[model samples]
Target: MNSLTHSSTSVVRKASRFLLTSRRFCDTSRINGDEETLKITWETSEMDCGFAEEHEKISVRRTFLESTKLSASQVLDTLKQDCPGFNTKLALDELNVPISGLLVREVLLGILRRLSFDNKTRCAKLAYKFFVWCGGQESFRHTANCYHLLMKIFAECGEYKAMCRLVDEMIKDGYPTTARTFNLLICTCGEAGLAREVVEQFIKSKTFNYRPFKHSYNAILHSLLGVKHYKLIEWVYEQMLEDGFSPDLLSYNVVMFASFRLGKTDKLYRLLDEMVKDGFSPDLHTYNILLHHLATGNKPLAALNLLNHMREVGVEPSVIHFTTLIDGLSRAGKLEACKYFMDEMVKAGCTPDVVCYTVVITGYISGGELEKAEEMFREMTVKGQLPNVFTYNSMIRGFCMAGKFKEARLLLKEMESRGCNPNFVVYSTLVNNLRNAGKLLEAHEVVKDMVEKGHYVHLISKFKKYTRS
Candidate 1:
C-alpha cells in the first residue's frame, strides 16, 4: 500500500465508527419520544370522557354523544352496560379513570331528569355536583332538557341561584329559551320579593331571540308595579301587541292592577272589557284584587259591579273575595251594606278575621254608628281575637265623634291595659275628642306627651288645636 491510500483508509474507518454510534443514539431517542406522545394522547382523550378505563373511555363517550336518537331509558341502558348504575356521583368518583365530556353530560342529563321527576333529593344533589363538573360543555339538547328539569326541581327545592345558573347555561348552549321559562323564573323570584340575581338573569335573557310570553309580561308588569314604574308598565303592554303574543287572562289582570294603581279608571274598564271579549272570565283572585283596588281607590261602586260580575260568571267567591268586597264598601262609607256582607260571609261558612272586623268597625265609626262599632269590638274579644290598634282607634274616634268622651277614655285605658301601646293615631284620637269636648287642658297634656315621646302626632295635634281655636 502507498502512503496516500493508507491515510484515506484510516479516515474511512473513523467515519464508519462515528456513523454507527450516532445512528444508535438517534434510534433510541425517536422510540422514547413516540411512546411518550402516545401515552399523553391516550391520557388526554380519557380525561375528556368522564372517568372510565382509558381504553373504554373514548368508545363510551362517542356512543353517548351519538345518543340523541336514543330514548333516555335506552341511553341509560347503554350506560348500564358501560358503567353499570352510572349516576353522576359515580362518574365524578371515577376521577382516576376517564370518560369523555359528552358522555359525562349524558349521564348527568339522565340522572338529573330522573331525580327531578322522582324528587330524590340525594340524587338531585349528586346530579348538581356532576353539573358543576361538566361545566358549560353540555350539548344544546341536553342543556335544554336538563334546565327544564332543574326548573321544576328548583321550584320544589326553592333553589333560586341554581335555577338562574341553569338558565344561563341553557342560553350559552344555544338552546332556544322562551318566555315561558323566563316567566317561571320571574314568578318564583317575584314571590320571594328579594331575588335580585333572578331579576338580573331575566334582563340578560331578553338579549336572546326568545320572545317574552304573556305570563312573562305579567311578571315584568308585577316587578315594575313593585317599584311603581307605571310608565314602563304602559310601554310594556304596547310592546306586547307588537311582539305577536296575545295577552291572556294573566295579562289582563296585570293591566287592570297597573291601571288601578295609576287611578286610571278608564284604562281599567277597557282592559276588563278586553278580557271578557277574549272569552277569559275573571277568576276569584281577579275579582278580589280588583275589588280591593276599587274600594281603596275612588271607585267603590265599580268594585260592586265587578263582584256581581264575578258571581254571574260562575266563579265561587272565597273568604278573601268577600273580605275585599266588604273593605271596599266600608271605604265607600256604606256601613249597612258592609254589615250585610259580613253576615253573608258567615252564613257561607267563611270565618271573618281581624281585618274584616276592622273594616266593619271603621265603617260604623264613619257612619256615626258608635253603638254598632262598640258591639263589634265586644264580638271581636268574645271570639278570642284581640283588637288590633286599628280596631281600638276606630272605636275611640267613634265615641269622640258621638260626644262620648268618657267612653273613649275608658277604651283608651283598656287598650293600654291590654299592652297595646298607643300609636300616634291613638293619642290623636284622644286629644281631638277631649279638646272638642271643651277639655283643652287634657288635650294640651296629650300633645305634650306625644311630643316628648317623639310620636308623629304633631300633624293631627296641630289640626285639633286649630279646630278648637
Candidate 2:
C-alpha cells in the first residue's frame, strides 16, 4: 500500500482497537448506564477522524491572513454592547466587525475572562453564541484555549452541561484532550460543589476515551481532594478499584485522607494494611495522615509510635508531619502532647517553621492558656521565626477573647511594626469582638483605620449597622 493509504488504515485500526477496548470495559464495568454515551462517543470519533482526513486532503490553505481594521478591544466592546442580552444569536448575526484568527482567539479569551469575573448566566449564553459564531467563520478555527476559556466561563455560570458539550465539540474537532482539560473540568465542577457530578463526568470521560493522565482515576481523586470533597474521593476510589485500576501511592494517600476526614477509622486501618501488602511503603504524607488520625483519635502514644515507625522505615518526619500531629493533638485538647512533639521535632533535626510555631500558639489560645500562647509567640520571634499574619491573628484573638482590648490594640500595631500587615481576618476579629463587648466607639475607630489602610472598606456600612443597632 502507498504511505498515505497505510497511514489511513493504521488510524482506522487504532480507532477500532479503541472501540473494542471501550466495549470490553463497558461490558464488565458497573458503569453500564454510560453504554449509550460510549457508543455515541465511538461513532463520533470515527466520523470526526474520517472528516478530518478528507478535510486535510482538500484544504491546502491552512493559514488565513486578513487585515482587520478593528482592534481586539474594539471587537470586545462591540460584542459587550450588542450581545448583553439572551438573544446572542441575533446579536452575533448583527455583528459586522472583521475578525482575523488572532482577533477571534484574543476576543474570545478576553470576553471569557471578563465574564468569569461577572459570573452571569446571560454572559455564558452570549459567550457561547460568540464562540459558535467564531467557529462558523471561514477564517477562524476555535483553538484549545478558546474552548478552555469558554468551558471555564460555563462552569462559573453553573452551566455544566454546556461545558461538557464544549468538551464534546473539542473532541469532534480532533483536539487532543489533555490533562489540563480534565483538570480544568474537575476543578471547576468541584468549585461548583458538584462533587458527585465530578466523578460522573470523570467516568463518562473515560468511556469517551478522554484519557488525560496515565492514571486518570488518580488525577480525578487528587482534584477532588483539592476541593475537600472527601466523600466523593472515597466513592471515586472505590469505583476506580471496581474498574480494576490499581491504586498508586497518590491514590492511597488521597483515599487515606478521605477515610480519615470521614471518620472511617476502621476502613483507614484496613487500607493501611492493604497498602503494605501491596508492597507500597508509606511515604511522609501517609505517615502524616496516620499521625493526624492517631492524634485526633486521642491515641498520643500510637502517634509517637508511628513517628518511630516512620524513622524505622527511613522516612524521616519533617516539620509538616510534626505540625500535623501537633494540630491534631491541639484539636483533641492534648496540649502537653503537642508541646512534647514540638520538642521532639527539633531533636529530630527538623527545625520548626513558622507554621509549626503558629499551630502551637493557636492551640494554647484555644485551650484558654493565654500565658502559654504569649510565651510561644515570644519564643518564635526570639528564635528568628518572624510571626506571619496567622500567628499575629491568633495572638490578637486570644487577647480579644480574654477582654484585653488595650493589649489587643497594641499587638495589632506591633504586628505592623514587625512588618506583618493585618488581614481581613485580623481586622474583622477586632471589630466583631469589640462591637460584641459594647465597645462601639473602639470598633468604629478600628473601622476607620481599616478604611484608611485600604482594607475591607466595604465592611464600613455593615459596621455602621452593627454600631447603630
Candidate 3:
C-alpha cells in the first residue's frame, strides 16, 4: 500500500503484458521439444501429474523400462513370501496384528514404477484385493499414503468404479480424507489421464455421506493448476469457499500461481490483497512464483527490482531468484546483464547451480553466441556442476544451427559418455541439418539411430507403408 508496493504493482502489470508471447515463454525449446511429433494422449495438459514440469523424451522413455530384476508380480510374490501370514492375518477380523503398513505398500508401489504397463494393469487387481483384505482387519490399518498407492493403481487401470468403492470403504472405516489423500488422487487424475472427470467423481462422493476435508479441496485446486486447467482451478476454488473452507495461505498461493500461469494479473493482485486481509502473509514460495512470472515475462529489470522488495519484506532472495533474472536478461539479449547478475548472485552469497549455468547457456545459444555458451558449459563441468541432458541438448542444437555438425556430433558422444542420453530433439536437429546439407547417407543413419532409440519416426513409417502398398 506504500510507494514500494505501488511501484511493484506497475512492474508486475507491465511484465504481464509479455504473457501474450509468454506461453511459448521466450524459448522455442520450451514448447513440447519436438513440436511436430504426435501426442499419444488426449489430455489438455502436457503434464502427467499436471503440476510437475515436463521431462525430456529420453527421461520419459526411461521411466517406462521394465525392471530386469523385479517384475511387479514378482514384487507382490515377494511380499507374500516375506510376510507369510500377512494377507491371512489381514483377512481375519478381531485380530490385532502389528503390520509394517508403509513398508509393504511402498514395496508394491516401487515395483509399479519398474513394471511394464501390461504388468501394471495386471497387478492392479492383485493390489485392490490386497488392500480390500487389509482394510478389513481390526489391526491392519492402511495409512493415507497406502490409500494413495492403491488409488494410483486404480486410476491407471481406469477402474473408476473400484476407486469409488474404495473411497466409500475408506470413509466408512473412519479414514481421514485429508489434503494428502486428495493431492495424490488429483495427481492420479493427471497421470492416469482422467482429466476433469475425476473432479466430478470426487464431487459425486458427497452422496456417500462423509465430506472431504478442506485440504482435499485445496489439493484438487492445486492439481488443476498443475495441468493449466485455469478456469477449473477458479471453479474449484470458489466451490471450496462456497462449501465453507476459508482460503488458507496454500490456497492463495495455488490460485495466485494459476493466475500468473494464465496471465490474469488482476486476479493475482486481488488474491494477494485478499490473502493479507485474511491474516495470511505471502511466504518465500509466493514470492518465488512471482519472480518466475516476472522473469518469464521478459521483465528482467522488474524481476531484479522485486528482489529489493523481497529484502525490504525480510524474505531472503534465493539462487532461484538470481537464476530467473539471469534467464530473463539472457532472453532479452543482455548477455552482459546475465554476467552481471551471475557475479551479483555470488556476491549475495548464494551459489549458482547447474540450472543457472544451463539457463545462461541456452540464452547464449539462442542469441548465436555459441562460443560463450560452450565456455559456460565447460566451466560447469570444471566446477563439478554435472550438466544434465537439457544442457547437452542445448549445445547440440546450437551447433546444428550454426552448421557446426562436427561439434554437435562430438557433443552427442560426450553427453552419452557422461551418461546423459541424447533425446529425440538432438537427433531430429542433426537429421534435419544433415539432410539440408546434402549428407543423405548421414541423415538416414541418424534417423535409424533415432528409431532405435525408440522414436516412432512416424513419417518414415508412413513412407515405408506407402511403398509396401
Residue-wise C-alpha lDDT for candidate 3, range 125-220, written one tens digit per residue: 667655665666565677867876787777677676667577666777777565455555566555566646767666545432224425566657
Model 3, residue 411: C-alpha shift (Å): 1.6
RMSD of model 2 against the true structure = 20.5
User: What TM-score against the true fold does each predicted structure earn?
Assistant: 0.46, 0.73, 0.64
Residue 317 alpha-carbon offset, candidate 3, angstroms: 1.1
- Backbone clash pairs for candidate 1 read 48-100, 48-101, 49-99, 49-100, 50-99, 50-100, 51-98, 51-99, 52-98
Error of 2 at 123 (Å): 3.3
Best prediction by TM-score: 2
Q: What is the C-alpha RMSD of each candidate to the true structure, in Å?
A: 34.0, 20.5, 20.1
User: What's the best-to-worst order under TM-score?
Assistant: 2, 3, 1
- Candidate 2 overall Cα lDDT vs. reference? 0.76
Better of 1 and 2 by TM-score: 2
* TM-score quality measure for candidate 3: 0.64
lDDT for each residue of candidate 1 in 1-469, tens digit (9 for 90 to 100): 3654454344233222211345433454556777988978999987876455665978876775566424334434533333335564444344322334445456656765554334556555655654555453444235455556557666555677677777777777677666556566766765666344555455446543343443555666666666565655786778767767788776777777778778886787677767776777667656666667656654544544554555555665677887888877787787777877788788767888888898888888888888888889899889987998988898888888888877887887788789987887788778877877788886776667556667663364354434322
Rank list by lDDT: 2, 3, 1
Clashes of 3: 1
Error of 1 at 26 (Å): 74
